[model samples]
Target: LVDHKQTALPALIEQLDSEERDHPIRKLAFTLRAIGDQRAVPVLIRAFPKTLLPASSDYGIKIEDPELKRWIAKHDLGKGRSIFSYLRAFREVVGALQQLTGQNFGEMELFGVNLANTESQRHLQREQFHQIAQHWAHWWEANQESHGVDPAYAKARVLMAGKKQGQLLDKDMRETAAE
Candidate 1:
């Protein structure tokens, strides 16, 4: 897709904020990450909240522990409320941002439902998520001018392409034919 960035980039950026239930936000972010363009940062940030753990539940993960599953099945604390965080599409956006910017803004931890059973614990979790999101947003505001293709992301792309296809594709996906 990077080779077709002239068209692919804009289309992906345009839909990065899509709220359609079946839109592959995760795949879009992944392609943008592979493209390694700093231009996608803002759109990626915009899409971040849609992937967050909803306010209805303190826990951000699906219950996978057999014991926890049994307990949740018995309790009415709000089953199915914590599944979003477990999906980790948010992490893909974060990972893309990290790759594109070569920065770490931190991510929220997934916790068991019991940990957030109390109102205070839930509130704390919510605050932490907000703070992390804020950090990324603020960082972008302050550092967008410095944004560009991260060297590491670029280098890895080159090496991977070379090893896989014996064709060296640069960060822009140009220079492939010459190589």
Candidate 2:
């Protein structure tokens, strides 16, 4: 909190887990954002296990071996060696939030989607991705990540599972979508 107003810390932390429930990073960021008491920049720099980091059942993402993971950890995320470090971009995320809310926060911590008007689509896509993820667990649980089930079929199965579980769809929801 650049302006050091940690009063909103709780609400901002809540937003971290709110982006999309399936968003592991968001949840991780929740803790990180809270750890520094809303000062998010340093929280990530200390290797705080934010998201998938070559670990266990992280819901089907590939887990590289220890050595490979170490190699990956040492390297920055840019494929084409750009000057911008992931951490820098991360700070920008926090900075933008402070600007948009006009809530002067010192010790700047970044959370949430980019508030850029262009990024409204980005937020929508992020939301849709969570919806898509609601399907994955069902597909994996029922079909074992697909035993001869093609991608399209798997997707349909996910929708069915999500609907059956009443995740984001109910009888009325289905009717509304149909209309």
Candidate 3:
């Protein structure tokens, strides 16, 4: 494990956009939280809803709540399984954002709607979270300067400023780690 905060932060940030299906997004979120950098707040907000469903599920499909509930109930994910496999990653992203910003956007209001036990309720909760992500984005835009976050990372409202598709991870960003 690399201990250099400079070397580690950008790599972790880049992983948030990893297209790899099983990319352990929750781990990345937790790692960012442990780093305790204000910089991670913006990126976390950017990724808040990227993994609301299992990787095996279609990332682009937009199923209505009623249909999603029927699908979840009919499939019978078995005794120990859940529809929340990857949704936990989204939760971790929320947790990291709150920790870094010292703000409570209301976890219950953001995620705890209806206990989410019913499949229909889970779908509704997922939609609520997507809306909450928007709230976080708006809040960050207004508060990033006060938190000492850079404008480049804040303005585009995404993970990295120059995030090249072919660029190597953590290659050039380390030099500015101390800043």
Candidate 4:
């Protein structure tokens, strides 16, 4: 799979922008992490905003309680369904980014906060996730080019050695070895 990841990377990235709800974009993002390529960083950043909104209705439902709806509308709490979906997807996207970069950048703690536990928690966590997402976006913009990539030949050799050894090398070590 490591040997095949280079060929799959392009398609996985392209899936980030696909409008098809049936597309497993989250899975694709995680696959990019499994590929362990630094090139996936920018693509994952781009996918972050897109992931904040769930594609399926199963994630949550619209606010049906009139009192709750009015309170939310007045207080600027997001639409109930969107908030739930956004938090769920936000956590997932952040998880993928962490996996790809080996850099937490504070997202690990932010993502750990359970936004769906209660209304008050959701409101606070929503703001936190928003800020964290923006921070990640800006960080990517400033640092993407410096993220670095392993040359194809070198990556292939490492993959071959790992396969022969019947064990996968740690991703961070692989990148360090490449450097």
TM-score of each: 0.52, 0.22, 0.56, 0.48
Which lDDT values do the candidates have, in the order given? 0.54, 0.33, 0.57, 0.50
Reference-based lDDT, residue 39, model 3: 78
- lDDT at 52 for candidate 2? 15
Worst 10 residues of 1 by lDDT: 153-162
Q: Root-mean-square deviation of each candidate, in angstroms?
A: 16.6, 17.6, 14.6, 16.8
How does model 2 score by TM-score? 0.22
Better of 1 and 3 by lDDT: 3
lDDT of 1 by residue, 1-179 (tens): 76798678867876765442323665677677767778787767655544544323323446778776664344322335544232245655677777777887546353222225577776665445445555565566567766654432222212221134344224323332223
Evaluated against the true structure, the overall lDDT of model 4 is: 0.50
TM-score winner, 2 or 3: 3
lDDT accuracy of residue 5 in candidate 3: 61
Global CA lDDT of candidate 2, please? 0.33
Name the better of 2 and 4 by TM-score: 4
Residue-wise lDDT of candidate 3 within 74-166, one digit each (tens)? 422121333423335656676677678878777545443333457776666555655555566667767889988766567414323234554
Which candidate number would show the highest TM-score if scored against the true structure?
3
Model 4 pairs whose backbones collide: none
